[model samples]
Target: MRRHGWRWVLIGVLGLLVTGCFAPSGPRFGDGSAVPEEVSRVRLPVRPGPDGTWVVNSPGEGLLGQGRVLVRRAGPDRRGWRLALPAEFALTSQRPGSAHSAFVGDHSVVLVGGREGRRGPSEIAGLDLTNGRLAWRLRVAPDSRVFSYDEGATVLVADCRAGSCRLTGVSYPTGRRVWSRTAPGAVKVLDGCRADAFVADPVVGRAPCHPYLVTRDRVSLLDMADGRLYERPGLRIPPGGIDRITENHGRITLATAPAKGSCRATVVSESGGDGAQDLGWRYTFVWDQPQAPRDPATGCRWDRTLPLTVVRSLVLPDAEGALVLDPYLGLRKQLRRLAPGEYLTADETRVEVVHASGRPDRPLHPTRTPLRPPGLSPAARFLTRLLWQDGRRLVLLDHQNRPLWEAASACRAFMGDGEGPGVSLTYCDGPDLVTVRPAWKD
Candidate 1:
């Protein structure tokens, strides 16, 4: 007994040494009393747009609201334009595949959704982003929903009653019908084209790809120029209902949960808001080859553990922060808790807390050691230079992996169009929408 006790004591001390040497420790700033000088915050008089989709990419534009108001970047005076949405006409929140309800295109901003509850048909209206002038309005099917908008084409999938669905492609500037396709049963759209709507920046490192139409039976690649379907036999949807689908680094991952059991899928309000239901999770099947998806990694989870991508790796939430999982769903690393809850998202350079319905923000950053991609050893996943917010703190980390500036922030949730430092962050503090800008000396 004495010998075994000594051996366990030695193991405990070694574990402490390993963690003490590598755990990321830094100063936690703020008493929530005063705002820092280096951090610039501009408050607009409006509620935040949508819940889970807050992505801002331009410096000139700042806040967008579900009430259909677009407040431009504020000068010192906090004066900005307010384009009021029609009375009782609330904007739609982000749905699966679609990044934002107010899809901001190059030539126009397409707003989808109609009157709050008297739902017969939804309206898709195109407006000038700067002036908020209604260019054209098209009434879609009662079951209409925005799937995605890429380049000048905005795809809407509707008429999903029974088993048949229709896909309509609308032009961004003109609101004219480009093309339409019909498929049997409920259809899922996967971003297969070089589209900037689902990404952080539209210009940098953005490449072209094809769009795919997925059904319960088969997968079809979409032609963005026109509504042509190219069926792909390489990938196939696994048995059971699909829960969530995520794509990163040219690979697709599909999450499926049991439909009829104690662990069946459950819908809960993420922000505790009315009429907004966020589906929460189980098995993950990753597919990269021109063949079917691999065997699923099976696990039953109750708490919301949405698939988040960081450094091109699949990250799932844990108690501390998140877990970087390998292609085979093996634990790689445990990231530090930067925000509240498990709601986090990331892009190439930055990671931010994502919130829905005014929930507490959760922080997501690595703690102990740098994470590398699967099968790669020497190369490391690095957050070289980033400006991100965790609940109430805004941190600007420099190239040397040092905090350039940390300040007490009012940004409970960050509203962004995508990821990265250049992405504009808009959030709601009480009744006012706040946009945060870091006053960097560079």
Candidate 2:
């Protein structure tokens, strides 16, 4: 949960927050009336492509099958060309056991191909967006998430969910399996067949000790250099005890709920960096009632290593900004842990190193550039989107974030793709799809 005089807020699609009542004269959709049948048709507007070209997937935004990728290039007005799938490739999620899904890529799109029987392996196919031709077709035991080799690269890493699943790198143009190695557990990749997914964090170090994976039991790290996994000599995640585990520079923070005490975290070093010491006990639950959106410091581990000098109660103020905490990487806001030790904080102007015991230890990282990834904690999203629409004029709360700029309501939602820059915020007003450019600026 969270406590904040400076609380972080998240909102609908593109995660904008439209606060403070607007004057009736604020720019708004002309009438409460919906747009014509043509405009209201289900089409998922993707991040705009370069040179006035845009890609949109349709049949209403969803993970299941039922529409084609509609490519919209700027004409006298935006017109749809090249429907990615036709009658022959019409998709349906109806299956006996497996649920169908899809993931979109830069040059290709992948989806669960139609299957014949109720119980069988999951069939997937990738299509060349350029020609709307099938690039490759492969099958995973169950489901998968997409991963890419690098930015602007075509290679896709499908994180298949076959518990104890291994890594199999396939050639982009040809679906032939290139490299395969067994790790610990099933590789949990990010998305299905409609949106694009990329490597959240690339492997690091001279030997590359990353390509993170989570097993049925514990989280595992893979070394891409040799296909060998990292071994933690002193680390042992007590079975059935901790709810979540996170790693940062060989450090582990455990989020759990004990039968007796309130929900708390125990920080331990896997590499004996801190000599296997117990960092300290911090309770995530405020007032003994769980906070709506969990403050990351209470639940996940931050990417930054906690300084040894600051042992307890580190309070980092947001200074009026949003923090998105990944289940693994802590908070996008990155406060991480709060109160009881010294920690760092930031604002539009500067990043301050605050100490619970005293003052500054000299500013560690500066402002403007956050040391951590700004993620969307599921709690924050559920909590901040308390009220979105007010009467007619639809406005998005400009959290002033660079990576995102999409909007969602009961009426419609546009998915955000940090896959590339120039976030074009697209929102729907009845039948009309409106696009907003320059997502964030001065």
Candidate 3:
């Protein structure tokens, strides 16, 4: 009887080993299929610091406070500069005061409006990040608003009044004025080219005026060293006006509105001549909806009319400019339209229940998901925010929107807590983690 029991045990051990080898272990939710774990946190220690650590902080109050700005090392050096603000400064909600409108770079965090009680015109102040000191301040016309940042040369573009706008480049260390230029009309800086700045000359009119009628806007290339205009030429368009301009990989894509309705997009190579040779290709959208192209080469599809309310925000991925449709108030459906071929790629898109202020019987589904991790119980899932896409990977988060793990390129899942079924199981290898916050319970 002892020999027979020994044989049975050996057989069981062999079977277990083979199973482990063939079927890797991964997070298994209520659904039998293995769901990729959430990446609770990502720690990218490449920035070379005191153990390569960083922190994310938002001011406590007002417009400048609400903007979510990230500051990190400007380069690989430990003592290198860092940037604080992003390009856009608009507030999500209509707060009482001005919104957060600056990017921190190298030695300075650029501010839009003047100081709290200082009665003066709107100014761009470079605040020292190391000691929170004001390094330099440039007074902009009270009617002007500093909008965009040029990372190449650390230049800023502001919309000033009196048919004139200013483009100023400031030195990072001493905050001394490097160079400044005033344009012919009230030009809103659209995007930056290679050492050049693109501006949109707004038509002189009221709130709902046509933007195209005010043509003759110039795409001027400025020498970073001397702030001299390299090329300033008039770009002629058809009867319709330009609706929007998007920049990617040093190329400017002009989305032009149709005379009657709808819009078409044209890709202009920034390096080419200011004349007709600069126009690379033009694409027209058949439908009137704001649909971004799936791929950069193919452009957007205007034919397919999606229900207007179904779409939330359109994100153009990286320099390739592939458009990802973020649907907020609909059956969870995330769609990506590739350019060139105009092909559609669909991944996992599901709406999980989340809990906020209401009771379990009738929970609230907020449009914006709160940050959390994933793999909470049914009750906990209510308080969790669903992890969308991180770069190219799709992730699942917990109730507090903390990443549990992420599946990359449809394979190879990386978990945060280091618990999952996969071969490449490594902690702190997911999206570049700048900071880690305390997890919240459902």
Candidate whose TM-score is highest: 1
Q: How do all models score by TM-score? A: 0.54, 0.42, 0.40
Between candidates 1 and 2, which one is better according to TM-score?
1
Candidate 1 lDDT over 176-255, as tens digits, reads 88888687765656543222122332233443344566688765656655777766444446666445444444344454
Error of 2 at 377 (Å): 21
lDDT string, candidate 2, 167-233, tens digits:
6665556777667775545534322111211112222331122244545455445443334555444
The numbered model that scores best in lDDT is 1
Off by over 4 Å in 2: 1-99, 104-121, 142-165, 183-219, 223-226, 241-245, 248-250, 254-392, 396-425, 436-442
Ranking by TM-score: 1, 2, 3
TM-score (C-alpha) between model 2 and the true structure: 0.42
Model 3: how far residue 60 lies from native, Å: 20
> How does model 1 score by TM-score?
0.54
lDDT of 2 at 2: 60
Q: Looking at model 2, which ten-residue stretch has the lowest summed lDDT?
A: 190-199
